[model samples]
Target chain A: MNASDVVTVASSVLLVLGSLLTLIAAIGVTRFPDLLARMHAATKPQVLGLVLMMTGLALSLGDSQLGWKLTLVVLFQLITAPVSAHMVGRAGYRTGKVRSDLLVVDELTEDLRAAREETDREQAGR
Target chain B: MRVSGSRKWLEKIPMVLWLTVLWVLFWGDLSLANVLAGALIGLFVMTVMPMPRIGFEGRVSFIGTAILLGKFAVDVLLASVQVARQALRFGHDPHGAVIRVPLRSHSDLYLTLTAVLCSLVPGSIIVEAHRLSGTLYVHVLDVPAAGGIAKAKADVLAQERRVLYALATDADIAEAGLPPRPWKRGRTDGPDPTTAVGPSGPAGDDQAVTR
Candidate 1:
């Protein structure tokens, strides 16, 4: 009924929702067919879940100082998550971890093929 | 020479301020001593480890940034649910596609930001980014769910447009072959919606695959 009570209830709801999202992300990572798809599960929902969990924590703590630190955590996650995901996806592709069978259309292969041919032609000319 | 040195020093101010802010935030206290200490630490760190300067010539638009951030949040929420549903649905095989989308902007800043934003959204992930050509090879989680290849490419371009609006200059926007600022436009007829999503223009730059 009171303001603090309402804040507590909201934070509790956010905590549960955030946990559920993170759990779904875990399931997606396990169930997705390939590395790239798994990257999606590992990165996307996890980001929103982290943001939600951080917001809930900050709200529950009721300290402006802690809130700023929590904001930094979310900011750092937002900045770094994509970089890590990109690196993993690139590495997976290079290592042939991506399943071509699962992909409906692939354009990168053609581009890579053309690039390699151009280099080969240059080497032949030399 | 002196002017250039001073300008360089001026350029370092923002970095210093940002580092100092981070330092203070880490300590979770705002006092005169903390501020001074943070600044000193910031200056020390920058001097010790210099980073390559990223070029930024765009003017920031508050409204555009608001739209970008607001839509980004919503996209994350909705797409998360979509991906979650895809994962939960039993026996459903999601067919992904690696579609190359040639972005309009040539700048690395916009390219990186667009890549980062696209990666956060569930369905599309940037598998490879060709810096020279400014093309992003995105892997879509579900081709049909994403409304086909053209739709996915357009989504990436749309993300770039929102990014350009937020930070890119009007000249850069025009250079990218996009219409001028929407707020400043007088004409209702923008570039044909078809061309906006159309296959590679007259340039013939995007020639990888067409279906």
Candidate 2:
């Protein structure tokens, strides 16, 4: 096959795969047990799906200007996805919405316990 | 080396170049006029909003960076498949855990990179990062056994080593207590792996029960 034909095949494949991954991510968000797991479903496939979609578009368009713009989209998504996930997870933990049954190890709770005990000791000493 | 005097401007070159490239992309052109305008705008933004200096003391190793990128790409693909399989299966028990991984590197840049990398992968998401102690609280799906906790900590340490080799300075390496060369085969022992005190019961039991 010719180069253009190869590009067309690759782009089509990427678009299909990207959409599928994004669909799975959506299902995961709804189906996952806890907030943390939902966050995993929310961030991972979404970012990768976006990256794949952008890659497909960049390949098919073959325009330098458009390619750079697509790159910009991917870059911004990569930078923001984790930061937003971090914030949501932290918020969920603070609000006690996170399912502790789902978690295997939770050091933050221990830290909080220690802090509370320290405060109690200080008050008793005073 | 301390950034002071005119040399401080040199340090900002990477940011300026990145901003200029972003501007060019936004404008959808790479003409001489666009380039000049983009650079000018970049300079204006940098001067108007001075960023906090988070001492980025690291040198890029081209080969190391390339390897890390390749590994990251592979990890993303593999983890996607794993997560997808778990999501697709019917009545599969979702055993997620939040384990604490103490990092060797104290650098904020390293911690940020580690968190970003972990979150990007499908199974694990960094819930919280303690800046003072350099510990990452990662929520990972499917911890079949307690050994999984150790494996997770090891994976984070391996990632840190790759990042250290790719961009950390000699002093940063020393401060992180890493060898001059990246550790091979997960040989570099990390700090104690702290297990999560998960709420009693399997995650599947709580699947439909919402807070």
Best candidate according to TM-score: 1
For candidate 1, the docking band is medium
Q: In model 1, what is the error at residue B20, expressed in angstroms?
A: 1.7
lDDT of 1 by residue, B116-144 (tens): 99998889999999999999999999988
> Could you tell me which residue pairs clash in candidate 1?
none
Listed in order, each prediction's TM-score against the native is: 0.89, 0.86
**Interface RMSD of the candidates, in order:** 1.0, 1.4
Q: Score each candidate by Cα lDDT.
A: 0.84, 0.78
Best candidate, lDDT-wise? 1
Kindly list the per-residue Cα lDDT of model 1 for residues A28-117, writing each as its tens digit: 888988888888888888888888898899889999999999999998998899899889989988988888888999899778889999
Model 2 vs. true fold: TM: 0.86
